[model samples]
Target: MNNMIELKNIIKIYNSKKKIKVLNRLSFSFKAGKIYSLVGPSGSGKSTLLNLLSLIDIPTSGNLRISNRNIDFNSKSDNDKIRAKKIGIIYQDNNLLPDFTAMENVYLARLSIEENKKKAMEDAKKLINNLGLSNRSNHLSSELSGGEMQRVSIARALINSPDIILADEPTGSLDTTNAKEVFKILLRLKNKNRLIIFATHNRYFANMADCKIELNSGKIKRATNARIK
Candidate 1:
């Protein structure tokens, strides 16, 4: 299998008045083209792990390589470039710009990676349509329903054609039907040559992943293949 991400002896620490260890020498390798679900109770370091993977937060100690290149977290520009072009991140909260229209939000992601505005708009239009937001493209994020907003978020994430997608509770805010719709789009997006890492508390949704790893006390219990249909 082709490796998309490699984490070796990773450690994360939160320090203010005291030091709190989150990840304790965690080691794992993730390959492309399969959906990976990270399951854990609240504060089990699932968010911390996803933050590190998404390059938004740096690991206190460890080596992180993406697409075979080691990342230097200290360089903001370098990280930004890699993140915009190589990775797509979906937050639990739809982090859409409330003032921007759905099309604008999706187009912004494409523009961040590509220089040509016309090309980006064309691509964004297709993605918005595919995500079932074509009719709402001109509407501001605040005007859309919860599910519509989430789909727009997904379209924005995919606009850059990222090799790795890091989704944190992607369906946490949607209704049951909407959640299922979102998951279906995600599963269809998964290929044998890309990586999809999602963190969720929903067992039913987690069971749909190719591999499920439950996190507890900064460590993974075990990783197993899913048997659910």
Candidate 2:
């Protein structure tokens, strides 16, 4: 299987007044065309692990490679380029620019990769329609509902045609009905060959993934067989 992301003996630490270890010699390889859910309680280092995988945070020690290329933590410019081209991140809060319209938010992702404004807008519209946000494309972030904003966030993440989507509790704010709808959109997107990995405490939602792994005390427990489809 072709791997999209790899982590080798990764370690991350935090220090304020005292040193705190977040990740301890962690290693994992994520393959393309698979959806994996990271399950654990809050403060279990799920978000930290996702941040490390997404290249938003550097490990204190260990190796990280995306699409088989080593990521140099010292190279900020190259890391930004790799992130813009290959990784998409979604946050639980949706993190929409309250000032920008839904379409603008989605289009911005494409703009980060290409400078063609016309083409970017066109592509963003297509994604909005596909994600069922075409009607609200002109609406500001404040005007959309929780689920709608989340869909917009997903559309933005996917508009760049990224190879990997890292979602941090993507549906944590939604009700049961909206949560299911959001997952449906994610499942559809995952079918297009992008690796989907998310951190979530909801076991019901985690069961929908092809693979499930638990994190505790900065270590990944064995992945067990879960609902696969």
Candidate 3:
């Protein structure tokens, strides 16, 4: 199996006024072709762990390897390049450019790695169309509804054809119908060569994953496979 990401004795501490330990020596290996659900309560550091995986935040002490390559947090430029090329992230809050149209928001992500605007827009259009946003692609981000914005955010994240996808409460704010819609799209994204890790509080969604990883008190409380028959 392909080990997409490996964490060794990882720890995260925030030193503001008081030292708050978020992750306590986390060590785990995530393989490609599987979906993992990170289930934890509020302030359990689910976002913190996802941030570390995406290279947006570095751990206090530990070794992180992605696709067999060691992560060098000191190399900001290189890290940015790696993130642009390999990792896709879907935030709970759709972080789109308020002034840009839905299509523009999606295509701009491609401009980071290449200078081909034509191909970028074409790819973005295809993604948006695939997500059933062909009629709304030209609409400004501010004009879209919660579900539309979430779909656009997903299109942007997949623009790079990333090896790993990290989603933080992808459907948390949507209604039941929209949540199911967004979640169905998310489940369809799984492939043999891609690793998907999502954080969720909903038990129904958590159980849908291949494995459920529970976090408590700054450490992994339990990890159980759902398909262990």
Q: Estimate each model's TM-score.
A: 0.97, 0.96, 0.98
The backbone clash count of each candidate, in order, is 2, 0, 0
Candidate number with greatest TM-score: 3
Q: What would the per-residue lDDT of candidate 3 be over residues 1-229, giving only the tens digit for each residue?
A: 4999999999999999999999999999999999999999999999999999999999999999999999998998999999999999999889989899999999999999999999999999999999999999999999999999999999999999998999999998999999999988998999999999999998988888899999998889999884333
Q: For model 2, which pairs clash?
A: none
lDDT for 192 in candidate 1 is: 74
Candidate 2 has what TM-score?
A: 0.96
User: Between 2 and 3, whose TM-score is larger?
Assistant: 3
Q: Model-by-model lDDT, in order?
A: 0.90, 0.89, 0.94
Worst 10 residues of 3 by lDDT: 220-229
Ranking by lDDT: 3, 1, 2
Q: In candidate 3, which residue pairs clash?
A: none
Q: In model 3, which regions exceed 4 Å deviation?
A: 227-229
Off by over 4 Å in 2: none
Query: What TM-score should be assigned to candidate 3?
Result: 0.98
Candidate 1 residue runs with Cα over 4 Å from true position:
none
Model 3 CA RMSD to the hidden true structure, in angstroms: 1.3
Per residue, candidate 2 scores C-alpha lDDT tens digits across 23-141 of: 88889998898899999878878999988888888889999988889889999888888888888899999999999999999998888879999999999899999988889999998
Comparing 1 and 3 on lDDT, the stronger one: 3
